[model samples]
Target chain A: MRVLGIDPGLTRCGLGVVDGALGRRLSFVTAGAVRTSSDWELSERLLGIERGVQSWLDEYCPDAVAVERVFAQHNVSTVMGTAQASAVAITCAARGGLPVASYTPSEVKAAVTGSGRAEKQQVQAMVARLLALEAAPKPADAADAAALAMCHIWRGGAQDRIARAQQEFHRKAGTARRARGV
Target chain B: MRVLGIDPGLTRCGLGVVDGALGRRLSFVTAGAVRTSSDWELSERLLGIERGVQSWLDEYCPDAVAVERVFAQHNVSTVMGTAQASAVAITCAARGGLPVASYTPSEVKAAVTGSGRAEKQQVQAMVARLLALEAAPKPADAADAAALAMCHIWRGGAQDRIARAQQEFHRKAGTARRARGV
Candidate 1:
């Protein structure tokens, strides 16, 4: 399965696409960033991001999309902008009929470097080695996006299956209880 | 001029439209809420909001759009969701080529009730009286939206003119300074 991962931001949004499935070797397809000027109006910046990401989705046509989940930051404006960007990505993916998943920064690090506390350099290095690239992707945001894509390829499918199974189990259990009328 | 006001939320987004220009008596156009199910996926919920807001823009074609600016909340998820919805509203307005403005809750209250610390009932009562309606709009969200539209009608035009004048002044000053070879 192919997956597209996005590190959503207002000024700089990173995107990476990977081709792979569970228990299979992953290959990098593309990695890049969409940048918007701070001088522009907020709506203009958002529209720029929307157009850029939409173009990427149209080009890559990934089976699924993964985005960095935004959490609280010390700066309220920064966090709000990040969340807004993240939402745009999610909406775009849904519009394209692609399943969307979100991973925290630590989750991406853990999946790529086997340590949730891994440093940025460690995560970048591992992403390079895992993808068999001679060098890490330039710019931390690009490398982070590549790592996120890799993490989703490695973890998302299995996690989704497990969740489906759990849901089915619960549904069956409820039906059985209702049949027994207890 | 007509203004569309949005009270952004994940589950229930309130939208209000009003017809008026600065220094003119305002008249109510419409007020309603866009709701999404919590049972839906995050992307689905966001998509619903996007479609709903976009349809409103298409139908109303307001001169400008106003959204309630979100503030930090004790619940991270709730705040993030709100910010996301706000972004969607802004995006729709921008896509429609309508200038967008945001106001804080206190600002809306102050504009409608003459007090930033006014209670919800006071704001609703004031909005009903100002709109010449027999009853306040149903649901606090709808009333808040109407109040926000009224606020923008009363405040946004003057604010925009002042901002434009300031920009023009700075531009002229820069040109004069450049002519002096400074």
Candidate 2:
């Protein structure tokens, strides 16, 4: 299955396309960063990110989309932007009816490097080795996206099933609540 | 001029439309909340929000959009969702070519109640009084939205001009940076 991974940020959003499934050799399709001007309003910058992600989705048509999950524990100033940018990508993917998953940085590193606490260079080297690339994708964000895509392919099966089950359960409960007119 | 105000939240996004420009008799167009099921995934909830906001924008056709500026200092568990939801609305507004402005709770309260520390009930009362409504809009979220729209109308002139000026400056700077091929 083909997967698109995103390392979301307001100023620089990374996109990586990988074609593979569990137990299959992964092939790199493309990797790059979508950069937006920090000078722009948050709304405008978000619009730019939306357009960039849309263009990638249209071009790659990946079977699933993976985004880096953001936490509130990071730098106070940048965490909000990271969350906002991640939201744009996630919502856009949902709008297109694609299944989406999010992975923490350590999850991606662990999936690709076999160590949760792997260093950045170690993850990069492993990603390059796994995809048979001469070197890891330039732009650290792109490499991070590649790692996320690989993680989804390796660990996403169980994660996606759990995610869907939770969504389905919530939907049913919501319907029941609405039917009771609450 | 008409303004569409949004109080962004994942579970409930408040929307209010008001008619009037600065120094004019303000009229209420509508006030309501767009509720989403908490059971859905973040992306799904966000997509729901996007659709709800889009429907309001299509029906209202406001000259500008006003949204609450979210801060990361609030409840840790919900602040990220708030930021994400706010991004969806702001991005949707920008995509539709609507000018969008964000005001903090204090700014809205100060604009409507003459005090930033005014109680929520006081702000609601002022909104009802300013709009000549029989009572404050039901559901506190909707009232907050109306107050936001009214705030935009009463204090939006200078704010909008400054926002536009900043955007223009950013656009120009961005162009110069690109021209320099940096």
Candidate 3:
């Protein structure tokens, strides 16, 4: 299973794609941002991000997508921007036909560094070590996205177990039905 | 000034455009939603919304944009979707070159119905009366968008005051600079 992880932002969204079944097999598919002039209208900027996300979705065709979740903030402006980033990511995932999962900052940190309160540098260093990369992902946000993808893989495996259990239950039930009929 | 209000959503985004200036005539211009099939990919649906928003922005050239602020939610999935909506609205405003303003749900309701605890129907009723419409805007989300826009106009006037003050300050400084001749 291919998993795509995204760190969404209005100005920049960092994305990482990885092979879900094989641990530590990650390729830095893309890392950059979609920027618009300050003078440009909001719609134009949104469209730019949409286009960029579409391109990625089309190219990657990942089985699943993961994103960062936002918490409440006191600054109205900051909260608003963060909310927008979350929306853009969701929209992209929805469009890509990929099931979307969101991981909170703490959860992502814990998954990557074994501690929810791990510092950014610590998380970055651990992410590099886990993925066996040349260097830590820059801008923090990108690294966080990559880590989120890893968390999803871990979580996703649990989901698979649940699915398998359900299937087994159904199979037994079907056998019981045939036995009763006989 | 014409203002467009957006209630961003992953499945459906409610949009309303109003034509009028503060303390003057106000009229509804257009209101509707950009919707996509849930069965389709999430990213593709986002692209549809982006295209729709871009067309609206290009056609209307709204002076400002207003969106609902995200409130805390107990349901993680709902919260995630709400964040995505907020981000899409903000990005739309940024791309359109329109000043973006956000209002809490209470603020929008209070502005429309004179009570923060007013129900959705009450707020919609008040909006219809305020805009002198024969009927409430269809789909509660659309009415909510309109209410958000109304609140922005009510509060955004404060921004105008700030702008005027800054312009006056610059004018005074320029005059002083001329006198100094240094």
For the second chain, the TM-scores of the candidates in order are: 0.88, 0.87, 0.88
- For each of the candidates, the C-alpha root-mean-square deviation to the true structure, in angstroms, is 4.5, 8.0, 6.6
TM-score of each: 0.88, 0.88, 0.65
Off by over 4 Å in 3: A1-4, A8-14, A17-83, A90-131, A134-141, A147-182, B36-45, B73-77, B180-182
Evaluation by TM-score, superior candidate among 1 and 2: 1
lDDT-based ranking: 2, 1, 3
lDDT of 1 by residue, A1-182 (tens): 88889999999999988898778888988898999999998889888889889999999899999999888864776898898888888898998899999999999999989999999889989989988898777777778988888888888988877899999999999999999995
What lDDT score goes with residue A26 in model 2? Answer: 93
Tens-place lDDT digits, model 2, residues A16-125 = 99998776789999999999999998888999999999999999999999999999989989999999999899999999999899999999988988889999999999
The lDDT values for all models are 0.89, 0.92, 0.73
lDDT string, candidate 3, A20-120, tens digits: 55444555454444454447554565667667767877887878888877666434445545556656767767755578887888888888788999998
Error of 3 at A8 (Å): 4.5
Please give the clash total of every predicted structure, in order. Answer: 0, 0, 28
Write the candidate numbers in order of decreasing TM-score. Answer: 1, 2, 3
Docking class of 3: acceptable
Error of 2 at A45 (Å): 0.2
Interface RMSD (Å), each candidate? Answer: 1.6, 0.6, 5.1
lDDT of 2 at A103: 90
